[model samples]
Target: MKDTKILLLLVIGVPILGLVYCAFMIGFLLLVPWGQNHPIITAAIFVLTPSIVSGSIWLISSARAKK
Candidate 1:
């Protein structure tokens, strides 16, 4: 029962956090017009943003699995 709750929370929470994080990154890109001038920075953010979120989710899920 407890694990189920934790899993449920993880399922619900990670995506929300990921989306929020991605939104924030995008907003940062928009606000920082300098980012538009630099393709590398923009590309880094676009690529790294999903990786960071998915990596975090994977870490959490793996940790939970170990438990």
Candidate 2:
């Protein structure tokens, strides 16, 4: 039961956290002016950072599990 609960938490929590991070990144991008150089790079960074962060969090959490 405890293991199932942890699995459930990871399944639900990771994606929700990732989506929230993505939303924040999108909001920040929207607030930025379009005239800047390398807009594509900026956009990529905004999208990728949160994803990487979320993946790292998931990896770390799973690695530290007692099982």
Candidate 3:
């Protein structure tokens, strides 16, 4: 029961935090004229950074699993 509640909180809270962060970034991009001008780079950075980070985490986890 306790574990279930903790898992439920994690499921709900993580997405809320992600949404809030996205909202802030979107607001910042809109507020900054440079963001409008260099949208491609900004988008690439946002999209690729997560991909790279996930890939790195996956590699580390896989390596640990092998050890």
Candidate 4:
């Protein structure tokens, strides 16, 4: 029962957290000027940063589950 609860929490929590983070990033992006230089780097930073965080969380959780 404890393991089931933890699994349920992870299933629900991670995506909601990821979506909230993504929304925050999008809001931040909208505030930036359109003519800013290095748009590619800015875009890459925005896109990659959250995925790295969420991916790491997912990897850690899965690894712990396997142990």
Candidate 5:
């Protein structure tokens, strides 16, 4: 893969995938009728999941660049 391609993907893919994951997770959480209705947990889900996913994407891209 080319450097430009990798950079472009990192610019685009990280936010897109991270947001998708966050939306999906939060949407599912809200859609459910049962569960511990905790605000902190919800906040953590909003923050952590996307962050971890984005970081993972970045790490993967870094690894790929090394290869």
Candidate 6:
């Protein structure tokens, strides 16, 4: 039962936070002058950062579950 709550939090919370972060980043990238200078970096940050974070979380959780 406790695990169910944690699972639900993980499923719902991470994505909502990710979306909010993405929206903020998009706005930041568009509004800031520095953001305009490097389109590739901005694009990569939007694309890669979340995958890396989520992948790391998944790896740690899976490892914990195996124990």
- Steric clashes per prediction: 0, 0, 0, 0, 0, 0
Each prediction's RMSD over C-alphas, in Å, is 3.9, 4.2, 2.8, 3.8, 4.0, 2.4
Candidates in order have lDDT scores of 0.86, 0.79, 0.87, 0.81, 0.80, 0.90
Candidate 6 per-residue lDDT, tens place, 1-67, comes to 6999999998999899989997899898879988899988888887898789889999999999999
Q: Against the correct fold, how does model 5 do in TM-score?
A: 0.54
Better of 4 and 6 by lDDT: 6
How far is 17's C-alpha from truth in model 4 (Å)? 0.9
| Model 4 spans with C-alpha error above 4 angstroms | 34-37, 54-67
Q: Model 2 clash tally?
A: 0
TM-score (C-alpha, index-matched) for candidate 2? 0.53
Highest-TM-score candidate: 3
- Cα misplacement distance, residue 42 of candidate 4 (Å): 2.0
Q: What lDDT tens digits, residue by residue, belong to model 3 across residues 9-57?
A: 8899989977986897799699989888999988887778768987999
State how far residue 24 of model 3 sits from its true place (Å): 3.2
Which clashing pairs does model 1 show? Answer: none
Which segments of candidate 2 are over 4 A away from where they belong? 34-38, 50-67
Q: Quote the lDDT for 21 in model 1.
A: 75
How high is each candidate's TM-score?
0.58, 0.53, 0.71, 0.57, 0.54, 0.70
Instruction: For model 3, give the 10-residue run with minimal summed lDDT.
Output: 42-51
Mark the regions of model 3 whose C-alpha exceeds 4 Å error after superposition. Answer: 1-10
- Superposed model 5: Cα runs more than 4 Å off: 34-36, 50-67
State which candidate has the highest lDDT.
6
lDDT for each residue of candidate 1 in 23-54, tens digit (9 for 90 to 100): 97778778888876896978887788788987
In model 6, the runs with Cα more than 4 Å from the true position are 1-15
Residue pairs that clash (backbone atoms under 3 angstroms), model 2: none
